[model samples]
Structures are given as C-alpha cells and as structure tokens.
Target: MCELLGMSANVPTDICFSFTGLMQRGGRTGPHRDGWGIAFYEGKGVREFRDPDPSCDSEIARLVQNYPIKSRIVISHIRQANAGRVCLENTHPFMRELWGRYWTFAHNGQLPGIRSKTLEHYVPVGTTDSEHAFCWLLDQIRERFPKPPKRQTTLWRFIHQCCEQLRELGVYNMLLSDSRSLICYCSTKLYWVTRRAPFTTAKLKDADVTIDFRQETSLQDIVSVIATEPLTHDEEWQRIKTGELQVFKRGQPC
Candidate 1:
C-alpha cells in the first residue's frame, strides 16, 4: 500500500518540516517508493511536482524537503504501485479542473476490481485505479452540483455520501482539496496531529532530527498534519475511525 500526507493551515504554511519525515518513507525509512508527488496551493496557482523516481533519492524530492513551499491546502502521496506502470503519469496527487478551480486528490489504499467503463467529461491519463477513481469522484461532484455549493455543510454532506459509495467498492483512504480546506475520508489507516500554543518538540520516527515549532512560529499558528501513519514519536495523534470524514481548515480538524 501507498502512504498519504496532508497539511491544512488557517494561513499559508510551509510543509518542509513534515515533508522531510514523509520523504524518508518513500524508499528510505519505509517501503512505499515506486513514485511520488505533491501539490502546493498558492491562491489561484497550484504548484505541483511529480516524479517516477523514488523520492528517497530523487533530486526533486530533496529540493522539496529543503524548500519551504507554503500552502493553505496540501495533498501528497508516496506510491507503492498496485496498478499502472511506474511512470510520471501514474503518480498520485492528481489534479483536475472543476468549478473554475483546480481540484487535487490523492489516495493511500488499493481499490480492487476498479475499471473504467466510460467517462463523460473527465478522463484518466494514467492507467492507475487511483486515478480512475479520482476521475469518477470528480464527475460525481460535478453531477451533484454544476455550480459550487456555498454552504460548507452542503458540500461536506455531498462528499460524505460519495465517500460511502466509494468505500463500498473498496478501500478509500484519501485526501482531497480545492485550495480552501481539506476533506479527509479514512476507510482504514489514517491519523492526525495539530500543533499550536504550548507547543512541544516532535521527533520524526524515521529521521533522527526533531523540530520545536514554537521557536519558528507565532502565537496564532494552528497547523494540522495528517498522514497514513503517525510521523512523530511524541505527539498524541488522533486516529480517524473507519467510515468517518474530517474537514480541516487552517490546520485544525472540525
């Protein structure tokens, strides 16, 4: 199975610190290294990078780990390749245009017996089942609301119903966003931890380094980090129960 990582911040926040730990799982400290990709939402522009190479050794991954690319909504994944060829087109964190905005999606679990019957507007460029599922999900959303639903609860409910439909097909742990907030649906393994006032140090389980966010952040900072597995050894991460959906904005789950 692949691994997932996501960050939701009330303000534009850098993912460098948490990304360094996730990069270690992409063929270094963990086993998911077939391919990798990440997305950083910067207003109307979405800066995304994908690599077919193992992130543990890829120069691009190294650069991502070194640079502080900030975003309000971020979705990232480290692939383990259950379907599709090992190529850039098959990487996770795929993007599609929807409701005049670029919607991003990434999946962590394998969906069995997934095949494309037909697509109306969007099509899958890659052969991965994950991409196929993403396309179908986007299509469903567009079908339900040709225009964006203004109410948060309405949009959230729409996604909740759709997630249940997908889960019936197979495993559906995922992170989805549209530059505002993140919609996290956990079918299996997923955990979340938020850092805020009275912050403490966190040591990466894979890396030997630790970071004290208090030294680098302000009093109002509240950033939520979500992953397939807990990244740090110290923080008490809240694990999402199966079939539950979480909405994150400005780094806290609501």
Candidate 2:
C-alpha cells in the first residue's frame, strides 16, 4: 500500500509543512518507501516531480522540500509497491491530459485483477494496477461525455459512480484533480483538516517541527489538507467515511 496527501486552498499555498511530515514516512516513520511523487496544479499548468527511490533520501525530494511552489490544488503519493515493479515508470502521482486540462491521480491501495478491465482511449505506460484504474476511469469519463458536461454536479456524480465501481474490485482510496477541483475517495481511510482565520501552531506527527500558520496566512485564506492519516499531532482531523466520495473546491468540501 501507499500513502496519499492532497491540498485545496482558496488562495495559492505551499504544502511544505504537511509534505515534510509525509516525507518522513517514506522511510522513517512508515514503510512506503519504494517510490514517491507529487503534482501541483497552478492555474492551467502543473508542476510535477517523481523519483523511484525512497523520498527520505532522494535528492529530488529534498529539492521539493526546500522549494515553496504555491498551487491551488496538489496531490502526492509515496509507494510501497504491490501491483508494479519499483521503477520510475511505476511512480505516482500520474498525470494525463483530459478535456484540454492536466489531470493528476494518486492511489493508496491495491486493486487485484484491475488490468483485466478493458480500456478504450487512455492507456497506461506503467504496469501498476493503480495506473490501470486511473486510465480506465478517465476512459469511462470520456465515453460518458465527449466534451465537458454543462453541470459540474453531473461530472462529480459520475466520478463517484466510477469510484464506487472500482471499490467493488478492491481497496480504492485515492486523490484526483483536474487542475480545478480535488476529488477524494475512501475505501478504508482518509483524513482532512481545514485551517482559516485564527489559525494556530500545529506540530508534525512524524517530525519534531511546528508551524504557526497565523503568521503565514491572511485572514481570508482558507486551506485544507488531506492525508492517509492525521499529519499533525495537535490538530483535529476529520476522517472520510468508508465508501465516501468527497469533492473539494477552494478549501471546502462540496
């Protein structure tokens, strides 16, 4: 299994604090150290980085830690290979172009026999069940609506339906984004927290570090973070129920 991290903010924000806590789990606090990757959605563009090595020791991961690239939506994953070989090709948060926008996906569970499922348009370059499922999901969406739908609810419900079908196969906890909205689905576990005005200092669960968000944020800034588990030791996190599909926009669940 892997671990997932995501962010949706009303204003552009860097995920440095949360990311640092997660990076420690890549090898130190957790066992998902096979590979790691992250994607940041900046308007219509995406900044992504991937490495087929333990994030705890990877130089690329270090660079990501040091850089404060701000984005409205972000998704990240650290893997402990179950369905694919440990290599660059199998590393996630995978990205693809859809409806003229870059879409990012990352999964934290295994889907046995997922490759047997048929795909029409999108084909995976990697041999992981996670990637196969992602391609299949996008293909289904493309088939359902040749162009973007008139209503966002239509697309959002369709995504939930697709995720439900995937959940029938196996554990399907995931984070997905189309550079506009962040979609999260839970088969087993996922937690989230929202921080806005009157923010307080939060301590990391995996690292001995703390951040006073009040000093770094404006009164209007609303930020949300989602992870496989609670990232901060002091703050309360809301867990997504099993079989739940949550859509987040501008730091609030919709």
Candidate 3:
C-alpha cells in the first residue's frame, strides 16, 4: 500500500514540516519508495511537483522540501506500486478539471476490477487503478449534477455514498480536493491533527527535526493535516473511523 498526506488550512500555509517526515519514509525510514507527488492549491490554481524516483534521493523532492509554497489545500502520496508500473504517469495526486475547477486525488490502497467500471466524462491518462477509480468517481459526480450544486452537503453526501460503494470493492483510503475543500475517506488507516492558537513544538518521527509552531504561526491560524499515519510523535493525532467520509473546509471538519 501507499501513504497519503493532506492539509486544509484556514489561511494559506506551507506543508514543509510534515512533508519532510514523509519524504524520509520514501526510501530511508519506510518502504513506500516507488514514487512521490504533491499538489498545492493556491487560490484557484495549483502548484504540483511529481517525481518517479525515490523521494529520499530525488532532486525535485529536495527542491519541494526547501520551497515554501503556501496553499489553503494540499494533497500528496508516496507509492509502493501494486497496480501500475513505477513511472511518472502512474504517480498519485492526479489532477483533472471538473465543474470549472481543478480537482486533485491521491489514493493509498489497491482496488481490484476498477477498470471494469464505466466513465462518461472523465478518463484516465495513466494505467494505474487509482487514476481509473478517480475518473469513475468524477464521472459519477458529473452525471448526478450536470453543474455544481447549490447546497454543499448534497455533494458531500453523494461523495460519501460513492466512496462507500468503492469501499465495497477494496481498501479505499483517499484524499481528494477541489482547491477549496478536502474530502477524506478512510477504509482502513488514516489519522489527522489540527493545530490552533498557542501552538506547541512538535517532533518528527522519521527525521531529526522539530518545529515550534508558536513561533511560526499566529493566534488566528487553524491548520489540519491528515496522513496515513501520524507524522509527529508528540502530537495527538485522531484516527478517522473506517468507512467514514470527512469533509474539511477552512481547516475544520464539516
């Protein structure tokens, strides 16, 4: 299985600290070393970086770790390659356009017989089952709503239903975003943490790094991070319940 990382912030925030821990797992501290990719949603646009090489040694991964690209929503994944070949096209954090907005998706587990599903609007550019499942999901969303819906909960509930159906197929831990809200669904393992005012210091589990968020953030900042496992050993991360779908907007679970 792969690993996932995502963030939703009330204000634009950088994910450098959490990403650093995840990068070390690509080849050094863990086993998900096939490839890695990340997407940052800045306003209506997204800044994406992908590498088909092991993140521990990839120059592009190093650049992303150093670059402080701030965004309100973000999604990332590190692959272990169970379905598709280890290549750029098969990387996670796949992007597509839907309802005039760029939507991003990253999957952590394998789904069998996903290719047998039909798609009407969206299609996969890669051979990965993750991408195929994404296309099918978007197609279901678009088919139900020819245009974006007025009430947000309607779409949210529909997404949860769709995810539950996918869960019936296999483990479907996923992180998806539309540059505004992040939808997280857990079929097995997923954990999250939220930081607010009077933040404290956190120590990374996979690297020799520590951050005093009190010095780096303000009293009004609210940031939430979700990962396959807790990135920091000091923080109290909450586990998402199995078969639960959580929608995060403006850094709060909605």
Give the candidate number with the greatest lDDT: 2
Poorly placed runs, candidate 1 (over 4 Å): none
| Steric clash count of candidate 3 | 0
Q: Estimate each model's TM-score.
A: 0.97, 0.99, 0.99
Model 3 stretches with alpha carbons more than 4 Å out: none
Worst 10 residues of 2 by lDDT: 108-117
| Clash count in backbone of candidate 1 | 4
What's the true lDDT of residue 145 in model 2?
A: 90
- Model 3 agreement with the true structure over 42-117: per-residue lDDT tens digits: 8999899998999999999999899989989999999899999999999989999998899999998889988789
- Every model's Cα RMSD, please? 1.1, 0.7, 0.7
For model 2, the stretches where C-alpha displacement exceeds 4 angstroms are none
Number of clashing residue pairs, candidate 2 = 0
What lDDT does candidate 2 reach at residue 13? 96
After TM-score superposition, the amount by which residue 165's alpha carbon in candidate 1 deviates from its true location, in angstroms, is: 1.1
Q: After superposition, how far is residue 77 of candidate 3 from its true place, in Å?
A: 0.5
State the C-alpha lDDT per candidate: 0.88, 0.94, 0.93
Kindly list the per-residue Cα lDDT of model 1 for residues 84-191, writing each as its tens digit. Answer: 989999998999999888989999777776663356778999998888888888888898899999897798899988888778878999899977789999999999
